[model samples]
Target: MQDYAKLRKAVEMQSNEMKRIHDVHIDYWKECSMFFSPVRGRFLLSDKNKDFKKFHNIINNTGLRALRTLVSGLMTGVTNPARPWFRLSTPDPSLRESYNVKIYLEEVERRMRYVFQKSNLYNVLPQCYKELGLFGTANLNIDEDFEKVIHCTNFTCGSYYIAQNDKLEVDTTIRRLNKTPRQLVREFGLDKVSAPVKSLYEKHNTEGDVSITVAIMPNEDRDFGRAMDKENMPYIQVVYEDDAPKDKVLAVSGYHEFPQATPRWEAVGEDVYSISPCMEALGDNKQLQHEEKSKAKSLDKMNNPPLVAPASMKNTPVSALPSGITFEDSQSEGKGLRSLYEVRTPIGELTNDIQEVQRRISSALYEDLFLMLANDRRSGITAREVEERHEEKLLMLGNVLQQLNNELLDPIIDRTFAIMARNNLLPTPPEELQGVTLKIEYISVLHQAQNAVALRAIERSYAFVSGLVGLYPEARHKFDSFQAIDEYGEYAGVPSKIIKTNDAASQAQKAEQQQQAQAQAMEMMQQGAQTAKDASQIDTEKLQELTGA
Candidate 1:
């Protein structure tokens, strides 16, 4: 029911573009093209350029050209306009990292050709005489419906697409069967099957009109022998043919198709034919599904917010403290305690708000940086360029954040500590202090944490920006929300508490002990209001008379 053709084309287009890059990457591996090596330097293939070139030329000259000619001639049983047949293999993830495109291609073709022939056998044989079916196995005298009989082939890769008529679906060269060779030999007997049985029980046979073969022609240098085996492993081949005969036929020699006794043998060629018109139509339908899925995925990410702090905290206000001394500390006994109260309520709100702003900005930056790194993986952007841009942006952001820290947070932090020190709330100084302390250690910790938040934000911003550019390098200007933090802007004033003096030790002790007193006071106020409400429930005149109003 699926339009496999369109899907195939979409996959083809996308894959081709990706494959071009992959092919370039292949060349890159041989030439040591990439700057950053994820696997360090050991396994990279820089020294094998000359060997790879020679290897490719050998296949193009011999095996592939012959295979193409053979495929064209064998299609409709006559040699004419030959349709070009490309190589295919099992979809092996492990093999991709160490892909031997040339050798793997040959092995796949060979196995596929073998599987295709066997698959055709079921269709040509009479239904009653078909030896491969479930019904024929149980009863040798049953009538078989060749018309109703739909032959199926279980390929080495377990892909059913080969059974279809429209497309050539090939998988990577990774074996999907779980059974071990010994287990297979004990169960299925390797002697009964073909010679190049890498593992036992791996049934490499053809069920339908599809051509399946174990394409194996390893080159000396590129073969990599045991190493390549560990990487791609080998896969079984399967093929099917819908137009083959439906009635049983007499037994024939498997090797009779290829008359040559030598390894360099030729296959019978058939007439070339264009793909069926019906199959072309199927390709269109599959393309639509791929587009819809891609669009939906894009929308989902757009709708989601950055995974971080609450929305309310995204924006924060700058500080604006009045230049009044109404609450100025005068009492030496209350110096340290004065700092807490000396900072006006509005100023406190402003400072908290500003801190939130800094936090958000920094977070955004860090996220941007991470996104950039991600983009580089897909966008062909070099890591060095991304890093360079990241450094520039980070320096700019750090400067702004540093300036803001100095102008806004620093002063408030200084004032707060001064108040704490005066009230004896801070730890006793190693030495008696008279003038402005070099640094307020308490605020310094908080400041350092804030700085970290800011620095990380810059990192994130770089990541996000890099990703945006990678995804849409040509149109990245549209995402202006990722504005640089270094743009010149007026800074908000620092918030500060009134400078007051107090009995440092006594006030510090009282603040600790009187925390319970504050709670008690609040409770008393609640009780008083409750009592007043109860008294007010009585008539107003009676309440007024009782209180001698």
Candidate 2:
């Protein structure tokens, strides 16, 4: 019923566009591939004559090491130890008083974490790092099944591309999969086919073939239902070609978004490829060092030369001569005798150059920061200084982290929450909070660290104002004490449960004021009663004096 030919043509067009970008970046990809697997590099594979093998013996993998280090650092910051990866909050600050909503959100977060843990998201996350490291982009697909409410799968680079869209969200994505006919039939519920077709599918079940799966949100105005009705095919399965509902498939992309001007989607992210020149130099330096060492060994072997003699004395060997043996020549007084040629190859400069290149490579990958932390204790560096240095490195990743939050973490959480909501795994919100939408707050160490910069600035400003207030008491009124406390608590990553809401704080203040007023009234009444008793005593003394007269 659906126009299969038209869809295939659109797919082919998208593929061709993506291929063009891939071709332009093939060299960079080859370098990254070689960094991980040297033999995969075009330069290594093109050695049909086996010439490079003889000279370039050492294939340094520092490039791969740097890539892994960067990836690990990113993961560590993203999943910080001090806080959860994400939490739910209300967009309206005043809603903090709604404890029921707060509790419901907390439950949502707990369930989300449980789902992720059950689905093995921790393992899936590393694949994303690999993709990001190699291709500067990562794709994560979220789906649901009977066994797992929310399941996640990672797609490697070059296997998927985004379609044209006016908004930032990915509405359509085309992915290539290699599956057997049997798998396709089983997955898509194609068992309703005729007997002969079933037999044919079973025959080729073992032989897998590549298939393209396109996910798109169809236009509402399109007559897809009419087309299916005309074909008399199954409504959902025939249209989607999958057993699962179309809306359940969520595709999320991480890192740089594709440029609008380009015909195809291309990720322009920062990665090891950004420092390709340094990585290339490191590899070359390593090969050169190996070559120099080989040369040095060859020179050492040629330190002593064997004497050459006429045909009559050809049988004489160099080992037969003694250490101090004198060479005697029957003709020309040994003038034509062979002489030792001293060969000297200085490797000190080569070693220094290699070391310098290694340093440059390390600098390019921010490895120097790690080294600083390693030596900080021994060097007696203060903790504050170490933290400041750490922040400097984290600042470099601010943009990438923001993208990951938007394109990776947020989508994953939203999809998981939606699945849970559909399954009724979340707590019921109170009537007041029924219409309120939950927002995500990232409290991971990296996010907190990002906030720390602004927090530090606030602290400095407060300290400076306090110093002025100390000099002039009247300056205290200029400071907003409560606002400062609240802002500090928020930026300091303090848990919401631990901090009192504004309404509660105001109630406590009013109660304290009432108690103070009652105490003051009781004191006034007690003083009045004492004054009346003193006056009564004075009148009694005066009457006693008059009776005595």
Candidate 3:
């Protein structure tokens, strides 16, 4: 009979504890929903550039520290003698340990310092907690008074486990198999914990069947363990259908809730889910959730109505909801607003990467076309041959680009080149000209060097479509087929100019030599005439002198 009475008391105590815990958990979820929903909604379409830095900074600066603080607080609330809340109670003669708080706070501060050192936020946010070391050491003595049996090894730097052993030395097998809150509290100290608070940890259980057990503790004060006044507690209430599949519970688990122009709760009395309350409590803040809500609301009201179905189709179902209406239907009809939104193509894994390479190659091909055609007026190569050469060069260029794209430079090259092209820095093909056979060849020196030393090979070849376009401007209208080529061969401009200058110089030299030859021929003819006259006079005198002798 005595045994039965004790059993009954234990059951009653367990029941009350469960009820309180259930209420606390439900409230926590409500706050979490309120905090995350608005942030998510606004962040989806927010200015990613402006807000991304701040968001990243917060996580970098405070992530580990905040995690540690909440974990430690939960441990303390369980071990505190005034209100032992976890499944187990503190050991006998357990006293509220002041040093423990200081210790946990110090650990938190230490983590914050480490986080500051490791993250970019270290430069942005001023050092508000500089003496974290001293503060953490000072608090180390706070939990010494508690009757705690700690199972730990100092050799393994951060592997200690603490638990309230009032009932018995904590079941060693249970502690080894699964860590309990009491065990973690002992090891990490009540000052700084590295685990999630009990309530958040329990919710995590519903999402993933992880073996991690939560460490529960009572709130230190009625104001839910926060430093602020009860009235100032920021809480957003939200309601949303939990459409999560039983198999995929974590799909939306870590969502934040925050208040904005569009309140986290869709309607106050409509039982909508909200993230605002949780954001207020946890300080997960955003600037643009507020801006977008205001913008969306104003844009909806001031915009003219969209187009409707023709009056001839009055009886059609399409008339009830305009065919073009996407966001709204009834009020948007007959306004003739252009549809600015369109469904985007789902990103296929292959196309996203390969397509970027193709685009770069395509741009280079056009540049090659202009470069080759604009400057190739003197090559003995025929217009048709030039066209063939362009085709060959383009093919070669495509191959090189494919190689570059495949070289595993996807992460850096794809995004970087995309930015360059979008900003119009990439060269484009010039308009095709008539009667010009444009040969465009794109070659990579690096790749070609491995095969053979192809010196002065046109890297990017651009040419006018037809040779006749330059000789006869009338053929310009017939010109077409301009393209961009890859960068593989040497530029053709300087070489072509050198050839033209050389030809002109050779012609000038030939003309000067002809004039000098003509002048020498005339002088020789005049001298020959004078010599003939002298010779005739001498022959006649010799004949007379010979006869007289």
Tens-digit lDDT track of model 1 for 305-398: 1233233433433222466333323433333211122212343444455444333332322334434544654688653454455665444334
What TM-score do all the candidates reach, one by one?
A: 0.15, 0.71, 0.18
TM-score of predicted structure 1: 0.15
Tell me model 1's lDDT, rounded to 2 decimals: 0.29
lDDT for each candidate structure: 0.29, 0.57, 0.29
Which stretches in model 3 have alpha-carbon errors above 4 Å?
A: 1-22, 33-291, 300-304, 308-310, 313-549
Query: What TM-score does prediction 3 earn?
Result: 0.18
Candidate 1 stretches greater than 4 Å from native: 21-26, 33-549
Error of 1 at 505 (Å): 22
- Rank candidates by TM-score, best first: 2, 3, 1
| TM-score, prediction 2 | 0.71
lDDT tens per residue, model 2, 432-544: 67678878888775677677777787889889889998789898898876667667767656766777767778899899999999999999999999999887777766788
Best by TM-score: 2
